[model samples]
Target chain A: MTQQKRKFGFETRMLHAGHIPDPVTGARAVPIYQTTSYVFEDTDKAAQLFELKQYGNIYTRINNPTNAVFEERIASLENGTGAVATASGMAAQFAVFMTLLEPGDEIVSSSHLYGGTKTQFTHTFKKLGVKAHFVDPTDMQAWERAITPKTRALYGETIGNPRGSVLDIEPLAALAHAHNVPLIVDSTFATPYLCRPLDWGADIVVHSATKFIGGHGSSIAGVLIDSGRFDFSSFPTIAAPDPAYHDLKFYETFGHYGFLMKARTVTVRDTGAALSPFNAFLLIQGLETLSVRMERHVQNAQAIAAFLAQHPKVAWVAYAGLPDNPYHALAQKYTPKGPGAVFTFGIKSDNARQAGKTFIESLHLFSHLANVGDARSLVIHPASTTHQQLSDAELEEAGIDAGMIRLSIGLETTEDLLWDLDQALQLT
Target chain B: MGSGPSLAVDVSMNTILSEADRAKYMDPGKIRAALSSTKTIAIVGLSPKPERPSYFVGTYLQYEGYRIIPVNPRATEILGEKAYPDLLSIPHPVDMVNVFRQPEECVEIAQHAVQIGAKTLWLQLRVVNFEAARIAEEAGLTVIMDRCVKIEHGRYSGSLHWVGMNTEIISARRGQRYF
Candidate 1:
């Protein structure tokens, strides 16, 4: 099949780029190849494929053609050399850590991260003999101080989950580079459409495709994009030959594609985090209109943020898009397009807990769901849902108070969104 | 405290629907009855493969005697039934319309179910629309939310195995098994 040129804008590229007409039947759409094994050319070719002598599908658990197209598309969008698709966003991060770090290695990460990421880093990774050092993402000195000889990477999010604080990516990236480590960013909130962290100096990017990338909330998938900028060769542990895969050195064989090759061959190969072809197909369809849907998402979010800021019943609002927001400058520095469509606000009521619950139950248009980045508006009380596992102090540290409510604006009419918010606030 | 029964009876009587409605709608009795009566179900999103939840759920329900009608616009058939594009397009009046579409699209399916005169509108777990529920209710249909009918059937019909138990006696001979 002739590969189509990647010439279209974000919207068009999303729909067409990195994918071509099926050579066999000329099918216009991506066909889900639901099979366990692929037909090898011959015995020698199968040996070459397994020996990492050539790239070809060996098993569905490691890779699939349908999923490869998705990985390629997202890597192109993020301006990365290559990407590794995973079963879910958490699995994507796990692949990154497992491929990059060994026992006793440390990761310097931001305090303001998604609860799941925090748990994975602080608890799960700890059990694996890796430690996590938490610091404020905006504080470059703190990040530098947190780094030690054992520090393997610096991690933060483009837009912190729930808290919505935009990180200063450039300075942090510089700090990580100076410390001989790469910056791993969770860009799930501010997807490449809003801000490409690779363009700003991030060395690696990960996403919960379960969110924005699967905009319609139909599937759970994730992707890890390698910027091809980080010189992993400086770290002999990762650049050297792997004893598991026939002593093949990733950096020597793949060069710029070393990180992604290692992640795919080792992490995904062993742990089995490969995304299903069906989910990948669903995400590709979602990506087709991502650029268009994101614009309306930002506009709706900004308008709702403004309306909530001025409402009598609102105690506080945290949206980087707002001029008075603490992270507004950082948002401008990193994401000039828009801050994103997710933000948190607090309702002013004596029984804020009950009021928040009541408000969520009262919403007509906005569905109360744990997931975000849907085609329809969604609302959640973090104190009761997402951050419920944390105590009062931990919740406060995570910037989630009892009155805090997180809103993920969708591609709905701004008037309808505000109307729903207004009625819900009145009930509160 | 002494008037609790009478007060409970008064509240139950004044409720929008009676105990029968609760038993029919919220309770698993209606689903049990449906399972006993029907042998076929037309799940609109059933895939051909077994990995998908829709495929597994539909297959499981079919295992319990309900025939699954996989309706897909692209597929010729799924699991032996001729896949129809829509409910109206189906040859027979299906006992239930199991939807796997997003919540926003449920209103149209509810309307279609009403048009096809389906006996039940089973919106799969995590997909619900109050407006659709109201419309179905007005059209004399039963609506259940955030529930899997297969799971309910397993729970209410005593067909599932349970392992957890509380015990007092340490010896095996004296130990009690509460059914």
Candidate 2:
């Protein structure tokens, strides 16, 4: 097989970068490697694979052919060295953190993040002795001051979950590099089609492929892509000799691919958060039409956000695509393609919780659910659903309000979504 | 709260340093020369505790074979080195006055670094003062702000890749030994 030389466009790469015709069966699409393990050619080959002397399929848990294609394709799209696919988006982020940090390490993360991620950072990571420092994403000094000697990573979302606050990746990356820490971006909202965080200097980008990457929301998958830029030599977890791999130095051995290799060989091998090949295949299908789907997604979202901002019943809209939004300039600087499709707006009513409930219940076109980045529109009341356990003060800290209605605009026509929202607001 | 406006002014001044000027100070060659040739580093605000960044970076620099002079008024000695009360109190010649102080304190330190005839003035990560940099640069000293010396050493000395940063260089094979 010959490697392609010319750099293809984003849409073209989305369709064709990682896979080619299968030589065995001449299959045109990515074939699911549904088996558990790969057979070794001989004892020498098996020993070489086990020793990290060579790279190939050893076990389905560590590496799968279909998942490898998905990984490569996403990495290419993200302009990264390589990627590791995991069972879910949360798992992908967990694996990357596992590879970068030890028990005593710390991460400075944005306050505006996915609810699931906040819970993981505040709860799960705390149990492992990893501390999370949450700071306002818009406050650069807060991020800087939060960095301590033990800080191993800086983390944020490309476009904040539900809030749609655009991250200033370049400045944040500069700050992280100044401290010799890597910036990890959760770019699930602004998928590579909208924004490539690595191009803005992020060291690693993770995604919940179950969302935008699996456009139809068919697969629960996630990926971790190494920007191949973060200098990790001073970073103990990736650079140091690991007893699990028989004292093999990952960075010394893999060079630019150290994180990807470690995440696969050590973290995935030990933790077992591998993505299934079938999910990888589904994600690949979503990847093929990502460019087109995202175009429609943005168009519909921009229109709905505009409509909501002007509505009499709407109290506030937080989409960065709006010219008046605080993150509008950041959106222009970072995600020039679009500010993304997920956003939230507050209902102007006295009984906001009841109003939000009525609005969501009345929306015939939008699906009231837990997920985003689907072909079908989604509506969720965070204060009533995802974040219901929190008190009023906690809700305020999470940037969620009782009246706030989170919308994940889909590929549906702008008129239909507007009608659904307008009728719902009237009902409320 | 009383220091808000002046700090804002300082940040604004720091932003005026253009990309080209910032690049001049942070040049890999310049960093390499500064790291390899400098023998003594006076670490201002070097903490006694192991958890502080000053202590951690100062220790790393010490391990890398530089003479680390801890500068703290409260501590008589730290990291097995005699701690000076100030840059002016260090009796011996200093190669670099590496500051771990706040941004507001840098201008005075830069002046002291110049008075002491130090070769370089290095502000640690998140400490940037354009006026201090100018004062030091005008006094014929190399000025590097908002960059960690330990990271620069790891990068230029070819040890950074061992941990996994791209370092923008690739090799067909891994043969050379690292520090």
Q: Would candidate 1 be rated incorrect, acceptable, medium or high by CAPRI criteria?
A: incorrect
Write candidate 2's Cα lDDT for A1-428 as tens digits. Answer: 11112335777768765554443455667778899988888886686567654445788898877886787778778877678889999999999998888899999999989878999999999999999999999999999999999999999999988788888999999999999999999999999988999988899999999999999978899999897777777789888888876776777555567778899889988999989999999999999999999989998999999999999999999998899999999898887778989999999999888898999999999999999999999999987887788886888876678899989999988899999999999988
Task: Encode model 1's per-residue lDDT on A11-59: one tens digit a residue.
Answer: 6557754454533455667778887788987786676557654455888
Let me know the TM-score candidate 2 reaches against the reference structure.
0.70
Query: How do the predictions measure up, each by TM-score?
Result: 0.69, 0.70
Reference-based TM-score, model 1: 0.69
Superposition error at A256 for model 1 (Å): 0.5
Task: For all candidates, state DockQ relative to the true structure.
Answer: 0.01, 0.01
Off by more than 4 A, model 2: A1-5, A389-394, B1-179
